[model samples]
Structure formats: C-alpha cells, structure tokens
Target chain A: MSNTPLLSTRGLTCRFGGLTAVDRVDFDVRPGQVHAILGPNGAGKSTLINLLSGELRPSEGEIHYRQHPIHGLPAHRVARLGIGRSHQKTNIFPRLSCLENCRLAARIHLGGVIASWRSRAAARQVDERAEQALATCLLTHRASTPASAMSYGEQRQLQIAMVLATAPTLMLLDEPLAGMGREETSRVTGLLRALRDDYTLVLIEHDMDSVFALAEQITVMVDGRVLETGTTAAIRGSEKVRDVYLGRHQQEQA
Target chain B: MLHRYPKRVPIIMLALTVLLVFYPLWGPVLIGDGSDFFLEKLTLMLILGLFAMSLDLLVGVVGLVSLGHALFFGLAGYTLALASPSYSAASLWWMMPLVMLVSALAALVIGALVLRTRGIFFIMTTLAFGQMLYYLVSDASFTGGSDGVFIMFKPTLAIGELTLIDLESPLQFFYFVMGMTLLTYLFLHWLIRSYFGQVLDGIHDNEHRMQALGYATYGYKLAAFVISGVLAGVAGMLAAMQYGFANPAQLGWHLSGEVLMMVILGGMGTLFGPLLGAFAYELLHYAFEHLTLYWQLLMGLTIILIVLVLPKGLAGLILDPPRLRLPRVGVGGLLRPRPAASTKARLGLAGHHKHEEG
Candidate 1:
C-alpha cells in the first residue's frame, strides 16, 4: 500500500447548534486498507463518515481525497470523485428491485444526460455492473426481488451492493452490520474482507469482533474526539481506548 | 397494480384506442348533427388530458407536486395569441416550437428557484409563481387586462404550396388532437421505462440515496420540469387553437387545481390514468350540468364518493380489482378502528420479523 493516504481529514469538526458532534479531528485512510472507526453511540464516528462522504459540511477542516480538496463539495460531487457511502439507517430504494437499485448506482459512471427515450434495459454495461455487484454481495439470487421484501440482512447487503455498483475507489460505510443476526453478520464480514483487496474502506462499526477481524487499521473515538489511531494490535493494547469505549462494551456483553 | 394484470391492460388499451380512433365515424350516428359539438368537447378533453399527463410527470413520477403547472399552459396560449398577426394566421411549424421554448425557459428559471425547497415549501413557491403570472396577465393592459386576446385564425401546417393540415375544420381538429394524445401517451410510456425515468423513479423513492449514487438530482428534476412544461405548452397551444382565445382564467389556480384533480382521479403514476381522468371528469361535468343547475354540488359529492371508495382512483378498478372491495357499512364496523395488521401488510411486512430494523 502507498504511504500517501487515499483520503485524509485535517482538523475536521462538525457542530450542530451548541453541541459539537465531531470535534476538530485529523484522520486518514491509506489506499486498499480496511480502516475501521469504533466508538460508543454518539462518538462522532458516523459524523466523521458523513463529513468524508460530503453528506455534511464540516464546520472546520480540509478533507483531501487523492490530494484533491473536497470538504465543501456536495455529496453527489464527492461521489463522482470516486467516493461512496452507505447509511447507518438502511437507505435503499425499497420499492425497486435489487437489480434496479444497483443499476441506478452503476449508471452514474455513464456520465452524461440520460437519454429520456431509450429503454433502461438496453444499457447492457450498467446491467452487467449491477449484476456483478449483486453477485459480489451474494445478492444475485435476489436480483428480481423488491428491496422491501428482502430480510434485514439481505437489505444491508443490498446497501453495500449499491455502493459497490458505483465502483468507488474509497468507500465510507456506516454500521454495515448494525442490526444483522450472527449468520448475516459473518456473511457481511466475509463480503467486507473480499472487498478489502479492491477498495479502501472507512467503516464505522459497533461490532468489535468483526472490526478486529476485517480492519488493518483502527481508530477509536469518544464524545466527538478521536481517542486513538493505530494498527489493530496497537489499538487492542491501548489503555485509554479500553477505559473509554471497549471496557463498557465488554461489560455490556458480559 | 397496473403491472399485475399486464396482459389484460394491453387488451383494454387496444379496445379503448379502437373506440377513440373510430369515434368520428360512429359518433355522428349516435348523436346526430350534435356530434360536432360533442366532438369539440372531446377534443377539449383530450387537450386537458395532455395537460394533466404533463403535470403527472412532475407530480406522479418525479414526486414534485407543482401547483403552478397552469403557468406553462396559459403562457403558451398567450404566446400563440401574441405571435399571431391580428389579420393573418401564423405557421404551425414556428409558433408551436416558439411557445414550447418560452414555456421551457420559464420552467427552467422557476424550477431552479423552487427546487431548492422541499415538500410544502416547494408547492407553495410554485403556487406563488403561478399566481404572480396570473396577476401579471390579469392586471397588465397589453395582455388585454383580463379581457384576454383572441386568435383570428387557426394555425396552418403547409409544406411549400401544399397545405398538409387545415386545422380549421372540426373533424380535422378532433383527429389532430387524438393523434397528439396517442403520441404523447406512447412517448411517455417509452420515457418512463427508460434510464432517465428509472433515475426519476429512484429520486421519487429516495432522493438522498440517488445523490449518494452521484446523480446531480437537481439537473434531472429541472429537465423533467422543463420537459413537462413544454408538453403542457403544446396542450395550451392546442386549446388556444380550438377556442381562439387566451384568457387570464387559463392561468388561474383553479385551472391548476382542476388538472391536479384530474391526475388524482385517474391515478397519479400511470401515464394512461390522466387521460382517463380528463375524459371522465369532463363527461361528468357535462352530464351533471344538463341534469341540474346545481351541477357543482353533484360533482363535489361524486368526487368525494369516488375518493373514499377508490383511494387509488378509477385506474385502480382496472389495475387491481381485488383491493377495490367496498367497505362494509355497519354501525359497529364504522365505529371500530382499523386493524394494524392491514397497515403492516400494505407496507409489505406482513410475514417478516416485525421488530427488525429497516
């Protein structure tokens, strides 16, 4: 992997009214690495992801992706610049089929005014990309099924499939396993591991086991600030991260 | 619902097309010489149907409920009247395109401003823009100050020395309108199944997700608004040709509301529904008028009944018959609250794990 970070934030901050959801934080994700962001609820983990994805404008900071400043750019522009994100809350077009959901994301790379008179099915490349994404996420069997009809785990897979279909080099995923059962969680973990070879991932997850297994780098946050940033083994050995976030999580599990 | 009975829908549509195409021939036999009057009415209905269909592109497909749709419709009529010489007819070739261009420009400007807002604010802003235009035409002296302007002659379509369509005759005008309506329906059918329409569907379903997928959704919406405006302009120009007058009322909010009602009455998302609605609404208006002086009251009651009974509108009857079961009328039934099960079922969560997070 290159030493130059694919995406890096310098002094990033987001304040909602009087509450600073994300304090001034410097963070980075090297190319082709699974970088996991772990924190308790309201640790500004999702907020940081939102900032990187351009869903929310930072109050203070510069976000550089591939050395291009992208802080103030809108989400669509950020996405066009090869960044994609999945929502914490399952955000997919529920009424549309799984294939259609992926097709909509894949077609963005076609990059022109959509021909209003042509059939959507005629775009063979978009369909192929969509099918490939579904296949990657093991959702190819559910291609014709409406998203709402799928199980919650399948829906989460569809969400990742949609981002995958966009063909972004860097992906910001918020809690991809937030509500999945054990089997579903393991399946998604496997999917993420497979994805690690192809794309740089910034994951915000509460599932510590999967976080340790899938991520090469880990960042722990507490109360809108980064507590630690290190390799998985380094973070596992950190005292401050244990006391602030992981200790409480383990206690709850116990 | 429409897709469920796909085989039947085409057959029904084919039958309807056959009926409409042969109406000119068969209509006179049934109505005698008064068929001309009915034909004129039908032509007007077709024009309004086109208008409603254009609005549906925004309201139904793009999920933009624009209350200012009449602005384009009325503006096109005024354009035709203004461009035509007081003593001579204008060429259909140029005037039609000019009016459409004007309407498109207006939509582009207004959509750019109003699309920045969401939901109720968007609706109000559109309504406000439409009202502003209405007053501009109503109070302005050059626009005849609510007295309206009249077109002296219908537009002529000619290729050099040969006249292709003399839009003056009632029979010819009816056929022209029918042809236009068919073309619009076919075009819209193809459009809604296209890549552009799929993006629109995604926007309608979840705009934020579409944005995350890297679509500049604003551009798509603006394009839809402009395209819809241009189509509404065509309908407006046709109306002016038929009536030979452009009035302030055409630009009024009531007309906009009426077109909205037509869209709802037919079915919001179905391209064919708006046309069905326009015909049904106008036919009801005509029938009710002859039945009593208090026709509006009867119309109001009928509409309320239809809405309560057929929540999906008239198209629902053909699309999904099973769901159109009438509510049982009983004192206990009326008093009892609806079961939550049905709501869950409607959401497609009937057999799934209810507590699972979406």
Candidate 2:
C-alpha cells in the first residue's frame, strides 16, 4: 500500500437495472502482491474484475493504473497498458495448438498486425516468451496439441500460460483453480506462487486453502460490497469475515 | 520455424498449378477436340475460385461471413466496363489502377461500417451493403441500368511503344487470369502463414480472449475484410475482361450466396479449398444443365448428399481424410461376437485407449 499502487479503484460501481452488480467497491493492489477477493455466491467478484479490466465500464467512480485514470478505456487498450485477465472459465482458441495459443498472445504484445505478415517463427522473441510461459504452466509437452484435445485441467493451465505470454505487469485471474483435481489444484497453486514474484496478481477464487496460503492481502466481499480488506491473518481472524463469507464456505467444506 | 514441414504440399501445389496453366492448350484433347466451351467454363471456374478464396479469408480464417463480397468484385467490373472503349476509351493502364483503387477504397468504407457488428448482425449488414450496390448499378443509366455494359475492345498492355501481354485473345486472357490467380494465391498463402494470419485465426477462435490479451480485434478484422474485398475486386476485374461485359448479376445477392457456397463446399479454412470448391460447383452445374432442365433440383440434392457423406468439403477429403479403422481379428480365429463377460472386457480395453486419446 505504501509503494505506488499498480492498480487502484475508488467507488467503482456497476448496475444491472434493479440490481447493482458491483456496489462502489474500493481497493488497491501494490506491485508484486497476491491479492485474493473472497466472497460467497453473488458477491460480484467477477463483475468487479470485469469493471476493472474495462470489459464493462463503471457506471460511477474512477479506476487508476500506474497513476493514470483508465476506467473508460476499451478492454484491449487496458490490456496494452499491462493488465491481462484470465476468464473464470478456461477460455482459449480450441482449434489452435497450445503453443499457437500462447504465441498469438505473445504476438499481440510483440508488434501485432505488422509482425503478423511474417512467418511466426521469424519472431524468435515471441516463441521464447510463449515457450517460457508454457513451461511455467507445465504445458510444454502439450504445446503442439490442439487446445480442444486437452483435458479440462490442461486447458485451464493453458489459459494461465496465455495470460503470462502477454507479459502483463499485472494479471486479473478469475477462478484459476475452478474445476481441477487435487493434484491439478496443487500444481496451479504452486504456479500462482511463483508468478507473484514478478507480476501483481488479483485472484478471484472460492478455494479457501489456496487463498489463505497464497494471498498476502485478502478482500472479503458480501452481496456486492467489500466488507473488509486486510492481511490474510487479520481477515482469517476477523469475527465479521468469519461470520459472513468464510464461515459459510468452511461449514460447506466440513 | 514453428510450422511443421509438410513434404507432399509443395509437390501437390506444383502439379495443380502446372495443370491449370496449360489447360487451355491441352485440355481439348482430354475432353473433346475443339471445344471452346470447356475452356470458357474452366476460366470462369478459376475466376470464381479467386472470388471464393477472398471470401474464405473472412469466412474461414476470420470467422466473418460477409454477404457483401460481390459488391467489391462487381464494382470493379462496372468501373472497367465504363472506362473501356465502349464508353470513355480509357486505356488499360489508367483504367485498371483507377478502378482497383476505387474498389479498395469502397471496401475500406464498407468494412468500417460492417466490422462494428458481429454474428448475424454483421452478416445482415454485409448483405444490405451488397444489395445497395446492386440496386444502385442496376438502376443507374451510366451503368446501362438493367441492360448492363460491355467492353468492345480488350485493353492492351504497353509501356510507350513496347507491347507486353495483350488482353484481347482468349488464350492471352486466360494466361492473365492464371497469372493473377497464382499471384493472389501466393500473396494470400504468405499472409495466412504470417503472424498476422495467426492473430486473425485467433480472433475467429475467441475474439474476447484476444482482446483481453491486448489485440485490437476490430482493427484486425477490418484490415482482413479490406484485404479480402480488394482481392475479390481483382477477381471481378478479370471476370469482366474475360467476358467483355459487366452486369447486375456480378453484384447480385445470388452471386454473394454462390461464392459463400463455394467457400463452404470447398473447405473453409484452407486456401486451396475454395479453388477446388469453385471448380466442383461449376462443373456440376455445367454437367447437370447438360443432362436435364431440372438441374437446380439435382444440384441441391448433390450438395446435400455431399454434406451427408463427406461432411468435410471436397478439398478436405483429399487433404485430411477421416480415419475409419476396422476392429482387429483375434489370432486364434476370425472375429466374432463373444459371450457377455469377454465382450465387455474387450470393449473396456478399446474404451480405455479412446479415453487416453480424448
């Protein structure tokens, strides 16, 4: 919070007619920090991430990144300014090979359309970045396999690799652990831990154990409202958080 | 470096090219002696192939099914007809460049408006634009209205006193179309292989994801549209010069649908598929008409049968034949149905193998 925040929002709000999906939420993520947004169903975590990522513009309030206002910019422009987002579902080019998927992501950051007219291999840097990201996600062996041919877990990992290939300074990941076996969950959890060293991360997940283990700062939400933003230990110990979001999930787990 | 080398691709392309380049000369012997009709249809097939290739650029590669593609192609033909000796006596030099420029600019304008919408809306907008052009041309007196326009004298290519390839003779013109088609193919082939091509493919696969990855999806789609439109225009220009006429039929919705059918029938994503699709469709149309007046009904049935049987287009069958493996017989004897338990055990092993693949 002391060092210039990578991304910050003030009173950001989104409404769906009668329902306010995101209700004037306020939070800031510092550089290289793992920030988790925890909430029960309908707490509007995805909506908040969408609003911040410029997929949906805020009806009210401001979002600043690198000390510049960016609430109204288009999603692509927001990404170019270094905020890459992974969807809640594993979203990737299904027909394209896993390496090609990551390569496409890297190519957008590397010169885009102008560089597109040359053979993809000619851009050595793009390949290296794609390979590096693939390796990080443990998808190197499946690099030549079509994304459609991949398992649910592999596709999920490939989605993260895609985000990483873009070389974003910050990544907004929505449910990175959503539909995974125990081993897959542990693999992704480890991948997230390593990723936090270089890029600021804002993760939205329902997994309490990974959230507690990885998050430096945790923001607990209830019914589209940010109830508290505190350290992992503080949020875990807070009576209010325990009674609201974690209590419900912990009981379900038990 | 990332693309794997295919050993047979170059050889196949070379054989197809050589056969096409010499078709007019030697084709008569194979079909029947002195059949100008065969040459004419084959030439038309090549031009339609080019048109379909351009559309496939949008439909297959970019996932935009543009219904306005004929507008660019027909407009180029219209411009050439008016510029030629029948109207203003404009030379081919100035006439061709001016018309191509006009068509490209028109594509840019239409692409800007159309690329804004998506899905059925985008398809509808393109259809509207194509119909608008068709109506404007058919209703206008300068365009000869419903009567259409003709090119009396084929434009000659010359630099000062030195003459290059003349556009008058059918043989020369066929060669011109061939050369243009080849150039278009080579250029597009290079483009699809490029990084830009990959991005366009990505956009088709998942536009939202590409945008999230920092791609200006709209801009790339528009550029692709214009490129496709320009290529279609070039094909239209060739068609006009070949037939010595430009009519409302060139710009009509039927033409748009015909080319779309060609792209789908050939294969959507691959470059050569459109060419093969155009040839097959044209040949079938010719053959059916010769057989009976109910050619339309027959053609429709054939297309349905093809879809049912092939599933993939004509090119897809040749290029990537679907695997059809039969069950292996046991060493002890020929295969036969086993008892319940053994049947289940055998099926389980096969199921396990399929599961690993899946």
Candidate 3:
C-alpha cells in the first residue's frame, strides 16, 4: 500500500450545541487497507464517520481525499468523489428489493439528468453492476427479496453490497457488525476481508476481535478524541490504549 | 412493468378505458335528458383528473405534498384568458406551449424555494405561494380583480387550409380532453417504470439513502415538480377553455385541497388511482348535490368511511384488496395473552405479511 493517505483529515471537529461530539481529530486511511476505528459507546466514532462521509459538516477542520480538500461538501457530492458509507442503523430501502437497493447505488455513475423514458430494465449496465455487487457480498440469492424481508445479518450484508455497488475507491463503514450474531459477524468479516484488497476501508467497530483480525492499522478513540494510532501490533501492546479501553474490557471480563 | 400490478387491475383498467372510449357515443342516450350538461360535466371531470394525476406525481411518487398545486392550474387558465384577443380566438399551437412554459417557470421558482424544506413546512410554503397568487389575481386591476377575466373565444387548431380541432364544440372538446388524459396517463406510465421513475421511487422510499447513494435529490424533485406543473397547466388551460373564463377560485388552496383529496381517495402512488378518484369524487359530488342541501356533510362522511374501509383509497380496492378477517374478540381471545416478543419483531412480521398479500 502507498504511504500517501487516500483520505486524510486534519483538526476535524464536530460539535452539537454545547456537546463536542467529535473533538479536533487528525486521522487518515491509506489506499487498500482496512483501517479500523475502535471506541466505546458515545466516543464519537460514528460522528467521525459522519464527518468523513460528509453527512455532517465539521465545526472546525479540513478533510482531504486524494490530497484535495473536500470539507463542507454535501453527502451526495462526497459520495460522488469515490467515498461511500454504511450507517450503524442498517439504512437500506426496506420496501425495495435487494437488487433495486444495489441498483440505485450503482446507477449514480449513469449521471443525474432525467434524459430517458426507457424502462429500468433497459439500463443493463446498472443491473449488471447491482448483480455483481450482490454476488460479491454473497447476497445474489436474495436479489429479488425485499430488504425488510431479509434477516438482520442479510440486511447488513446488503448494506455492504450497496456500498460495493457504488464502486467507491474509499469506504467508511460504521459498525458493520454492531448487532450481528456470531455467525453473521464472521460472515461479514469474511466479506470485509475479501473487500480489503480491492478498496480502502475505514471501519468504526465495537468488535475488537474482527478489528484485530482484518485491520492492518488501528485508531482508538476515547471521549471524542483519538487516543492513539498505530499498527495492530503496536495498538495491542500500547500502554495508554489498554489503560483507557482494553484494560477496562479485561477488568470486566475478570 | 405490467407484472407489478394485480391481475384484476389491468383487466379493470382495460374495461374502464373501453367504457370511457364509448362514453361520448352512448352516454347521451343513457342519460336521455340534459345530455349536453352531463357531457360537459364528464369533460370537466377528465380535466380535473389530469390535474389530480399531476399532483400525484409529486405527492405519491416524489413524496412532496404541495398545498398550492392549484397555482399552476389557475396561472395557466389566466394565461389562456389574457392571451386571447377579445374578438378572435388564440392559436392553440402557440398559446398552449406559452401557457405550459409560464406554469413551468412558476413551478421552477416555487419548487426551488419550497424544496429546501420538507414535509409540513413544504406544504405550508407551497400553500403560501398559492395564496399569494390568489390574492394577486383577486386584488390586481389588470387581472380583473376578484371578478376574473373571460376568454372571449376558444383556441383553434388550424393548418393552412384545414382546421383540425375546434374547442368551441362540446363533443369535440370532450374527445380532445379524453385524448389528452389518455396521453398523460400513458406518458406517466412509461415515466414511472423508467430509470427516472425508479430514482423517484427510491427517493420516496428513503431520500436520505438516495442522497447517500450520490443522487442530488433536489434536482430530481425539481424536475418532477416542473413536469407535474406543466401537466396541471394543460388541465387548467382546458378547463378555462371549456368554461370560457378564469377566476381566483381556480388558484385557491380550496382547489388544491380538493385535488389532494382526490389523490388520497383514489390511491396515492398509482397514476390510474387519481383518475378513478376524480371520476368517483365528481360523480359522488354531483349525486350528493341533487340529493341534499348539506351535501358537503354527506360527502365528508362518505370520504371518512372510504378512508376507514379502504385506507389505500378507491384504486386500492382493485390493485390491493384488504383481507377480510374477523376480529378475535370472544371470551377465549380476550383471555389469551399477547406475544411477549419485542414490538419491533412483531411489526416487522406484520410488514412482511402485508407485503406478501400485496
């Protein structure tokens, strides 16, 4: 992987009223690496993902993708710039079929203008891309099923599939394994591992085992601020990270 | 596209089309008395159906419920009245396009401002703009104030030596309106099944998801608004031509509310539903008017009953019939305990059940 960050943020901050959801934070994800963001609840990991995905504007900071500043851009514009994100809430179109959910994400590359009166079936490229994404996420069998009809695990897979369909160069996933059962978690971890070689991933996850298994680099956040950033080995051995995060976990386990 | 509809819906739609096609021929004989009056009423219903269907494109498909949709309808009618010369008929070829353009421009401007807000705020803003126009025409001297203006002559469609459509004749005008309604239906049918329509459906289902998927939803909504406005304008122009007059009432929120009611009464998302709604609403309105002085009360009760019985509206009766099931209210049912699972799971299963039925 290249040393140059595919997406990098300097002094990124987001404050909601008096509460600083995400304090001034400097973070980066290099190309083709699974960079995991680990934090406890309310540590502003999701907020950081929201800022990077352009879902929320930062109160103070600069976000650069490929060395060009992209702060203050709308989510749609940010997505167009090859960054995609999945929500912690599994935000797929529940009423639409799985294929349609992927097709919508895939069709963005077809341009925004309403120039055609032909049937959606005629847009073979969009359908193919959608199908391909479903295949990649192992959701091809559920293509015709409505998203709401799918199991929670399958829905999570559909979420990643949707991001995949966008053909994004960089992906920001928030809690992809948030509520998955053990089987679903491993399945999604497999999917993420498969995706690692093809696209850069910024993952915010509570599951440390998957984070350690899949992520080459890790960033831990505590109270909306980055606690530390290092390789998996360094973070696993870091004194500060253990004292604040992992130590607490070990104590609870004991 | 055809496969998406219920089996009975397509057959029923075909039967309806056949009935409409033959209505102008046999309708007069069936009614026997006041054939001309009935014909005019039917024509007006068709025009209003077009208007209601246009609004459905916004409310049902794009998920925008504009309370001032009548603005385009009235504005176009006024355009027709003002553009017509006192002694001569306006050219249909030029005037129709001009009126539609005017409505489109108004929609573009209004859509830009109101689209920034969503839900109830959007509705209120649209209603405010509509009311503003209503007062402008009501109080402005050039627009004939509250008195309104008359199109002295009907628009004419003519070639070098041939006249194709003469809107002055009731029968010809009726056929013209029927043709326009069919065209709009077909156009919308094609549009809603297209890639553009899929995007609209996506927006309606989950706009935030669509935005995250990289769609500039504002532009799509604006386009739908303009298209809907242009269609409503066509209906408005036809109404003005038929009545030979334009008034502030046409632009009022009352008219907008009526059209919205028609959409809800028929079925929101289905294009054919609004047309069905228009015919049903107008026919009921005509029937109730003759039956009692408090027709509005009866009408309100009927609407409430329909809403309670067929929540999806009149179109839903055919497209998606509600399952009839007896309520479990006997002693055994009352004694039984409710499921202890989370309500979310129950709701999800209930949604799935409904989806299967539909």
| Model 3: colliding residue pairs | none
> Can you write out model 1's per-residue Cα lDDT over B55-91, one digit (the tens) per residue?
9899989999989899999999999999998998899
Query: Which regions of candidate 2 are displaced past 4 Å?
Result: A1-4, A115-122, A138-151, B1-13, B24-26, B87-92, B322-358
- B1-358, model 3: which lDDT tens digit per residue? 1117766877887898788778767887898778879989999999999999999999888889989999999999999999889998889999999999999999999989999999999999999999999999999998999989988989898886588977788888998999999899989988887678888887886677788889999999999999999999999999999988999999999999999999999999898899999999999999999999999999999999998998888887876455445558776865555454345446555544543332
iRMS, all models: 3.9, 7.1, 4.9
lDDT of each: 0.87, 0.85, 0.88
Off by over 4 Å in 3: A112-122, A250-254, B1-3, B323-358
Give me the displacement of residue B188 in model 2, in angstroms: 1.5
Q: For residues B39-137, write the lDDT of model 2, one tens digit per residue.
A: 777788889989999998999889899887899889999988887765333566887787778887998899999888989999999999999989999
Q: Residues A90-207, candidate 1, lDDT per residue (tens digit)? A: 8887667899889888888764335312545547778888899999999989999978778889989999999999999999999999889999999999999999999999998888
Candidate 3 chain A lDDT trough over 10 residues, lowest sum: A113-122
Residue A154, model 3: Cα distance from true site in angstroms: 1.8
Docking verdict class for candidate 3: medium
DockQ of each: 0.49, 0.50, 0.49
User: How much of the true contact map at the interface does candidate 3 reproduce, as a fraction?
Assistant: 0.49
- The model with the greatest lDDT is 3
**Between 1 and 2, whose lDDT is larger?**
1
